[model samples]
Target: MQNVTVVDHPLVQHKLTIMRDKETSIAGFRVLLREIAHLLCYEVTRDLELEMISIKTPLETIEAPTLKGKKLVFASILRAGNGLLDGMLDLVPAARVAHIGIYRDHETLQPVEYYFKAPADIADRLVIVVDPMLATANSAIAAIERLKQRGANNLRFLCLLAAPEGVQKFNEAHPDVPVFTAAIDSHLNEKGYIVPGLGDAGDRMYGTR
Candidate 1:
């Protein structure tokens, strides 16, 4: 079974607490979101492959381990994902970014893809798919499926907050990919929103609502 890492770092928890407060100002919320994203990205990339190579030091040559292969390709699930992308990029400044937009049909509640763009050689690079909230898992799953169709085999999922139901559904559907989140909430409400979630991430991030 693939692992679902819920980051318990003190900083992550602290930041999340602030972000959840209804009184948190828009600027404050935005800053905290980025900070938490950077912290989570650190833990998610801990096991990235590395290779040792000889390099010259001030005095003599020495072997030092450096990241191996191509740079990471971050596939953001549209507007909300862009919030997370800014922070992740701070950690891996050279990472390539892709965008995917999906919306849920009001009646059928099915995912509908509006946009998708990725690096030409996604299959050869580590791909991290990101979104702020993992609620119904419809958008995340659909985004993953689209990436797979584009030849992305090395992929993982990342989010700030997730519902247990969404996590279970996504993991069962894509057993080969792992998921990482700052916190996992209890469940989704009838309207498909995660309880105690930070609300619509795209709305909060862009002041859309």
Candidate 2:
């Protein structure tokens, strides 16, 4: 995939498998999502710029590498995105966060924005959009679009699973924004759901129908 990176690490894959099982409890699903997010977060942020600065160690003074540039922002696409956001925060504690409230109209599968909030200086920071499933890509696309309108140029999309159709559509819509996912599933189903997907991520995590 040109702009898409699949995180195929054993831990990520293993946790995803457990998440996909229908019998997994809500608590278990939430825990696994956070764990997988930690693993995936590692891959997405692997290329961050680092600058060396002098630091005093127990025995001597040494120059240590630390992240360079402004703090990155994590733009979450509503209820489900929060699941991934929790773990991503665990990895990047200082990263800023943005919440975009967009819900899928079950009938049309279109994204309808209800609320959006973020830092004022997003234009000078890297924004990583987190949404667990990219089945239709409607919400993710809209969320990124809104962020760009707010001056966010450098951005990336992170998801736990993606459908082939969703991935292609997302790339076409935002070629400049790269995508990172744990797995690319078969395809989207009739109701705009990903086949072999673990079902509605929000519902699963919240124990809702």
Candidate 3:
């Protein structure tokens, strides 16, 4: 829990409860995920550095605060990650995006990479990796490794739910990157799903189940 920050805002908790209900419609699930993503984004980027810049107002020109570094890069991990990405984008409209296509091989519980696309200047920006669940952490770990191979140094991992096992593995693998999550559930189930999680995020978001 050293590098983790849980968003416990009342609105976030309320929305998450609705998302966890099995009877919630697909449309309702998708909307809540996006709405919660906005609140998560606010907390995750709370300490981003700012610098003063000159700006003109009706009265006079004055120094105004602006983000200090290059636009943040959001590295979304495959299908489920996109759900959170939609909401994150709603808040940070100018942030760059990276889509990493990797899925867990259900048998081995390992990750397989199929596609990757991102801005050329990824090395210069702060990369925030988004995924809906971090059960095994294999996919998230693999995705971050791929991005680091492309020269990303500053990074963070954001997820809607995380299992303690996955968090331990992730911290052991990439200690430098902090994790921001809405909740850390009890544990991972036998099939690598988070216990008490709202169910398969991809399935819920797309009606795939």
- Candidate 3 lDDT by residue in tens digits, 1-209: 87889999999999999999999999999999999999999998999999999999999999999999899999999999999999999999999999999988989999999999999999999999999998999999999999999999999999999999999999999999999999999999899999999899999999996
Q: Which candidate is the best by TM-score?
A: 2
For candidate 3, the 10 contiguous residues with the lowest summed lDDT are: 1-10
What C-alpha lDDT, on a 0 to 100 scale, does residue 166 get in candidate 3?
Answer: 97
Alpha-carbon shift of residue 93 in model 3 (angstroms): 0.9
In candidate 2, residue 29 scores what lDDT?
98
Residue-wise C-alpha lDDT for candidate 1, range 155-188, written one tens digit per residue:
9999999998898899888888899998889889
Model 3 CA lDDT for position 167: 97
**What ranking of all candidate models by TM-score puts the best one first?**
2, 3, 1
Q: What is the lDDT of residue 97 in candidate 3?
A: 98
* Candidate 3 wrongly placed segments (more than 4 Å): none
Candidate ranking (lDDT, best to worst):
3, 2, 1
Error of 3 at 23 (Å): 0.8
Per-candidate local distance difference test = 0.90, 0.95, 0.95
Task: Please list the residue runs of candidate 1 whose C-alpha ends up more than 4 Å from where it truly belongs after superposition.
Answer: none
